[model samples]
Target: MPIGDINVPIVGKNVVIAVLVQSHILFAAFIIGAVLIAATSEYMGMVTKQPRYERFARNLARFVVLLFASGAALAITFVLALVTLFPVFFSYLQNIFFWVFLVEAFMFLGQIIIVYAWYNVWDKLAYRKNLHVVFGFIAGFFGLMAMTMIDAVASYMLTPAEAPATDVARTFLNQTMVPLNMHRFVGNFGYAGFLIAGWAGFRYLKSTREDDRAYYDWMGHWGIIWGFGFTMLQPVIGYGYMKGIRESAPDAFDRIMLDNAFTFNLLMIWLTVLAVAATGYFVHKLRFSVRPMPFLRKLAIGGLAFTALFSVLNLIPADGHIATGITFLGGEETQIPLGGMYPWKYIGLIGLMLVGFFVVALYLRASASGFHWGNASRWSQFALIACSVTIVFTMVTMGYTRESARRVDNDPGYLIYKCITLDQKVVSENCPAVSDGVNTISGREAG
Candidate 1:
């Protein structure tokens, strides 16, 4: 039975919707994690009477709040996209995770109210500062819980356990559920922490007052410290996630990772080194707090040196080992594995983004005199615009990846059965009598 029987839409409407929904995900994450962290820090400072921490927290929280508003709005748009584009998927998901999504919605509303109150009463609620602080934490906690609930559904979709055939709820609560949510939570913090540090550094560069600049420098150091800590923890979480996937749905995980055996290994190797290097450099830069940490420069260089080395390794051919077990692009769709091992360019794209972040951080710290409005030094503006674009585009790609990976017409064990295969001979035998894959030709019922 060939799958050419069903007239599925070209490019698949589900894929488009998934991309839109996924793209909105990162923004929601920004609001929930980084912004929440900063907000909590502000409240903590207020209660402790730590003016230095309080000031940093205040400014950082403001920035995070602005970003969070945009993120929250886009998250609503994501839900809309889900209904508009992937109607079938939306239905299945709602039915499967009905209670979870409903709870998430309530949590979102609670978070919003908390955010509004927390921000508005910064001064008004000064008398009972502890109460206000608790409000912000409430929002942050609910937001985190909502995200965690949703992750179970996402993970279930990727790793649909055999249990679903018996009990759908059991399938939704599979092995990947817990680890994936935790992995993603830490990832959000790690990415956001770095941005906050860069923001602090930019402030330091902009201010003329020595004390103000010093305060910003210290804040920037703190941000990096948080980022570095999370960065280290990220790998552990990821390993657990991958391990869960391997244990539960080895085939799907293998299709994505093992098929790109060399590229995946090489990238992992370099990123491991990069994470360690970044952590060491981050600590060194903080220890001195003078100007770029001259003594610790070697460690930064060493870290990057390894990053570059692995970048080259990633470009190497893995044909020696995983050749027959990999996939490729732009070639004949021969045997599924034998073509090649290229898991698209998404991973390398992430690497490029990290490089861009560092470059922008450098420019942000450079003096205003160094900036030329026009004819010279345009890269700074370019980096900023690029960063913004990357955020949006990456969101879209993630959505697309989620749906596209479903492989509606691929192997068995998954029920993305939108397309139905038909037997041409059987069709020829009975023409208009057939009713898709469930029924037979000659107006007879299929068993």
Candidate 2:
């Protein structure tokens, strides 16, 4: 049946698809991220002989199992929706990327098996801690493989390969695919860490037992270290991802960076402000009795000041004139000068990146030199919560930016670039109903 030929009366297809897919991505990303963090915690426990780390890892594994089930359910629903409502489009994708899908299915099956088996036998395998940890790594590896396969398909929609469909290998490895894979790979860890930190913070605040409070406090500290450590690498990777888009689809890139710069800039501003502030606050509090290295403190202060400057700069409305030599469908959209030019925007973006790195470095140094996280200030723990909030907000904003750019700039609004579907295809109003496909014209029910 032709896709979108039968529009169900009560439900909007786009809304249903968006909600299901977004929910799936959120939960899937969390589960994928948690696996690595849990593995690291387990390894730390083994090496440092710290039972606290192992306990934290075990608790996280239990949490991942719950989220994994929910995520799997949402994934099934999302796939069913696609096959039911947009069969033609889904079929087209299957035809072009059958190998990728086949591999992804196997990887997913392995992930499910390994994750369940590993979690179920956690205590039974305790005496062989190394073996248990190896199982965790295997689970994470399979999950990563599954995610990479899907990422290729997702990225193909944005920057499709110029090669013919017959060249499956070339088509699967689209220009932006690897960069996106890298970006999401790092982002999963960062998001997972931040979320754990927030959860730990909440537990710490509510705990009545001193031992529980100390444990939660340590958990929160460990989570932030992972969170900030990876987040600091995003700007560089993101730039490469953007560059891939700009090269493959210039108009789409312009729509995001120039024509719709104002809105995108706002997201960046909030992202920078919250990230910098939270990291700075945490680092400042990490300094125990020994005063912060004067040079390091100065660098962090400089970073904070630069973060403020960039936020204000990105927030500044561009002069009514759109940048010359580029055309976009949304002429009404306003640009931001800071978001438009090279070196100027680069300076701010790179400066913010540098600051983030410095703050993380300072914290690690402090931790290594006997700065006890257990003694950290209450405000610092609160800052961890704030950091988590910013990470969640950033993920949503970035997701919106990517999806919106595709829709706004696409010719005829193809769901997958260069591939026309029922949404963009026109039908003759008085033509005979298509009996071959589900026909909404006669108000026939669609499942």
Q: Best-fitting candidate, measured by lDDT?
A: 2
TM, every model: 0.66, 0.86
Candidate 2 structure quality by residue, lDDT tens digits, 137-164: 9999999999999998888776666655
Q: How far is candidate 1 from the true structure (C-alpha RMSD, Å)?
A: 10.0
Task: Give the per-residue Cα lDDT of candidate 2 at 331.
Answer: 42
Candidate 1: segments with Cα more than 4 A from true spot: 1-15, 43-48, 164-169, 206-212, 260-280, 283-405, 408-447
lDDT of 1 by residue, 230-333 (tens): 55465456557767766655555665464434435544444444343443343334334334444344544554554454344445444345444544553234
Candidate 2 segments whose C-alpha is farther than 4 A from its true place = 1-3, 8-11, 289-299, 320-340, 409-411, 421-447
Every candidate's lDDT: 0.53, 0.74
Give per-model CA RMSD.
10.0, 7.2
Clash totals, every prediction: 5, 0
